[model samples]
Target chain A: MAMEAYQAQFAAHLPKAGPAWLADLRQAAAARFSAAGLPDRKVEEWRYTNLKPVQEQLFALDTAPVGDTPPALLQDSHRLVFSNGVLQGSADDLPDGVRLAGMAETMAENPGLLAGHMGKLAQGQELPLPALNQALSRDGYVLAIDPGISVSRPIEILFLSDGGASYPRNLILAGAGAQATVVEHYLGLGGGGYFINAVTEVEAAAGAKLQRYKIQQDASGSSHIATLAGQLQDGARLENFDLNLGGQLVRSEIHMALQGVGAEAALNGVYLLRGKQHCDNAIQMDHAVGATNSQQDYRGILDDHAHAVFQGKITVRPDAQGIEGHQLNKTLLLSDEAEIDSKPELQILADDVKCSHGATAGELDETGLFYLRSRGIPEDEARQLLMTAFISETLAKIDSDAVRGIMERLVGEWMAA
Target chain B: MLEIKGLHADVDGKEILKGIDLSIGEGEVHAIMGPNGSGKSTLSYVLSGRDGYDVTAGTITYRGRDLSELSIEERAAEGIFLGFQYPVELPGVSSTTFLKTALNAVRRQRGQDELDAVQFMKRLRVHTKALNISDDMLRRGVNVGFSGGEKKRNEILQMALLEPHFAVLDETDSGLDIDALKVVAEGVNALRGPKRSMLVITHYQRLLDYIVPDYVHVLAHGRIARSGGKELALELEEKGYGAFVSGTEAA
Candidate 1:
């Protein structure tokens, strides 16, 4: 069905008694999206990663109820299931002092609270995907942690998309002095082709801590574009790790703003590509205050005709004195046809700040390969070992043991394929 | 156990190891001493089947098989070991893991079951202690951040673990002090047995004093110019390669 037909069907299925505020926000967002349309290569930020596949493709929106959920993908994960766009199921073992539920429930219970935080951090501006998600999203989840609360187990949000186009939106609010870790997994089922356009807005209050792990392992024919925007207040810390292993075409845009003094942010990602798959990771960090620190590291391994793009920009405003930021992007091209384009930029306006950026793209070192081969290891085994080592640095940063194990297995399976 | 008959090799279109011949019987150790650019390193690389070295002429027979026809790993599995002159440092591969893999690979090639982790660790600890290599070095990446002497000792540790039928030590004593040289030489001497043969390549006779070769040969301009007993090494040490080369040219 065309996008217009899908939108009409979606509007008819929404709850009639839904809060008026949410209805108004949805309608306004739809108008904005229709006027702006999907992003194109003409946009500077989207220049390297074209969205033609996502825009041109038509998807049937998954509005039906989600049935039985599959077994937990990883043990020890707190499963929060979202069927179509509605939150349908949740695991019993949730961390203490944490409140998580479907978006509609949260909005109905606390209407003013939902109205205040939603769409505040991610305004879309020139980016159209976030706006599109905000307009078309039916229902999702909200995770909230009170002040001074610390959760030991990771909150797992599983977004299972049926064979239809789905827009999922999440709003995460970490109160002051609260600490939490969450893992958001996006997966697909059945042979139905679908597109997942998602936007997650994170707000870390003063002295709060938030660690997020986003795993994208959708099917080969699926298209996924996610925009994660984070705002860190004074004395707050945010660590985000993204592992993209499976997708036909994936573009992940992460934007962070250190709005308070003494705030710190760490962004790390690893993408393993094979066959004709294409994965792009674009990140931007804005240091708006003084005495802030930001560090970013992303590595990729490309095989066959796969292509990987990494574009990172670090902007140090004039008031952001005493800021220290570092960015590094490195890639290994396993085949002559595999392509990788890395662009790392540092724009500094403060003299007291120290900022550095580096980008490197090359094949595996012949000397290293020869050294391994001379040890009686076969060529394939040697390549596997080196590739594993190449991405181990990023994998080591995951604090959750169970999540790390799952990520490792996923990476191994992708490499073997 | 190993014989080289008129081995001629070239690296990058320039011929080295020109018409060299030598033979090593079981349990015997021979030292090849020469000046810089005398092809001491080239012989080691060619014997190990390293790339970029073209064996344009001659043949090498190991245990009555054509050794030159094998790949590097094949030769390694066949009990031929080459202690590199400048050991390559591989970051992120632990020394213990690397040695265990190589050891098991060779063993499997020889149709033997691999050693269990417990047994491998025990054996590695013993050899590492003998070579005076610290446990920390084994846990870290192979030879990465290791000092010159540490890298040389690690090479000896690998040599001790592999236990090849024939070993080639290329300048193992190049960047070592007196104490390090003694330790490495002791490691080599401890591996000496009736079934093993060694070809020690060096520029100085100091290493030979510890390993104590039964025969010594002078390699000049990629060919063996002179062959003699251990006394020849002493004569050359006293008179230098200048005298030998000039005398050979004059003759």
Candidate 2:
């Protein structure tokens, strides 16, 4: 399970079927990952989340077909099932101006399509996990929307982790004036110990808008680590929402580069964790141009010894002016043993900018509980009503009414169960 | 009917309510006037089964059942409602949700069918209109930014909606203006009937002027010092509680 052993073993088993450029790219990334091994507790980024639990697990990249065609989260949409990094079949439906293709099939059929795209965004990432993903990248999906074209149906990708370890590298390209919604759901089948290193890169052109929503419900013993790196152009917008419920350990990092004027980003998520589950949400919002705005709102509900970590940083560059970025994190500790550590950082080098950050962690309001109970509502129902009400504030921002209803129902089910 | 005999209660391990005996018929509206720290609020909380208002030596019988044997919500289901002086603010819960949930819960406890959304809204609209509560207020968070009189009116609205058999108004007129007090008192008056019993606790006579009580009791030093007709409230307002305090201590 040590890094050195896996490094050598992974290198020896590296597939030589790809082109020379891809091979070279993979080698360079592997070298970078080798130089800087997995971050430990001493590292500032990994301080709150202990990676020791994941490092102890041994994983092998063996593909075993589970043949899972699970029900779609949304009633009508495009669905794809990826089991152990292998796409089960081609994408469900196709509309004009939108292309959905698996990585392995695309590489085999049309190598030139991915020649200029793969490893382009992953190479620029700062985290070692992204580097590891680039080095061991396997089959995922690529969703490309044409310019000035808006898609009605959302693109849904169902990721099923059966056994062993897998690295899935995904990409989303939204052309100028394009608009779309993408959903990613990670689910584990059967109880087993595995590791998932996933990375998703998104590029939004000028005046484009894209919303990405994800739900992580892996098995209890699995460790799921994922990074979402997005770059926005002039007048572009990117909205990201994460609903983390399961998994023994989870680290979801959302990194955005606001490189153009009038670009905006909203990073919102919630972690409903219990039973020693640990989830860390790290966000890095870099405002490289003036007139760009961003906001981060995350809620945490920790119960039964669960621990959640939230670290958000908004940096306005020296020349950037008139940028407004704000972040707020609020947590409800339902049990005495539950814990939360929140750190909101604002590094403002710009002379004229508006940035504010705040965090709060507390238990349920006692007077509110008593008042509700005194009205004939049972004690448990009162708690559930209050907790769900607290979380629904952020989830209400979802643009689609159907998705919001589903999310609220899921949250209520979790509380009642 | 409700009965209390030798009721001794404590809050935070300190006895506040000494030996006391009181009785109320099903159709009577009684008022208790007292100075500060006279165990008035403690007695209301104890009757409603609030946590930490322990009854050390007492028997509170409501319809042949011991009040202490039930939980707070159980007491609510048994038709006991306490109108708080300061209504607790629920930041994310809307007034509509709170009212519907409370109504449905009480109905379920009473072995009756829960009202649907349409039925519940129709019932709530009747009370809100009489109390001058806006639809906007029902949509907003409960008591989040409500004015003082608005909060008191909201309590009265809830009392009418729940339709409790025994209602206790604890300092309901403390923060209301004269006009607001009239509105709230009218709302309370609407719900008064032959099957309902009311207990109004306050330190002023202005409220009793609007919703006149059948009987008035002056409390001092954790015991009822005097009992008389509704004229007792007017007398206490004129003379103040100095006489009642010194008289009870000397006795």
lDDT of each: 0.83, 0.87
Candidate whose lDDT is highest: 2
Residue-by-residue lDDT tens digits, candidate 1, B1-251: 88899899999999988899999999999999888888998898888887898999999999999987788888888888988788888776778888898888888988889999999999898998888899899888889999888999888888888888999999999899999899889999999999999999988888988999999999998999899989998998888888878534321
Complex DockQ, candidate 1: 0.54
Interface RMSD of 2: 0.8
For model 2, residues B172-248, the per-residue Cα lDDT tens digits are 99988899999999999999999999999998888999989999998877888899999998888887887778844
In terms of lDDT, model 1 sits at 0.83
Relative to the true structure, candidate 1 reaches a TM of 0.92
**Model 1 lDDT at residue A37:** 69
Regions of candidate 1 where Cα sits further than 4 Å from its true position: A1-17, A63-69, A83-86, A93-96, A189-193, B243-251
Can you write out model 2's per-residue Cα lDDT over A1-417, one digit (the tens) per residue? Answer: 455876786577565656788788778877777777778778898899877766644247766866656798988888788987778888766878888888777677767766766766656535888888877776788888899988888888988987788888898888998998888989888876788889998999999999899988888888999999889999999988898987889999988999899999999998999999999999999999999999899998999999999999999999999999999999999899999999999999999999999999999988888889888998998999899779978998777676777678778888998
Checking candidate 2 for backbone clashes, the offending pairs are none
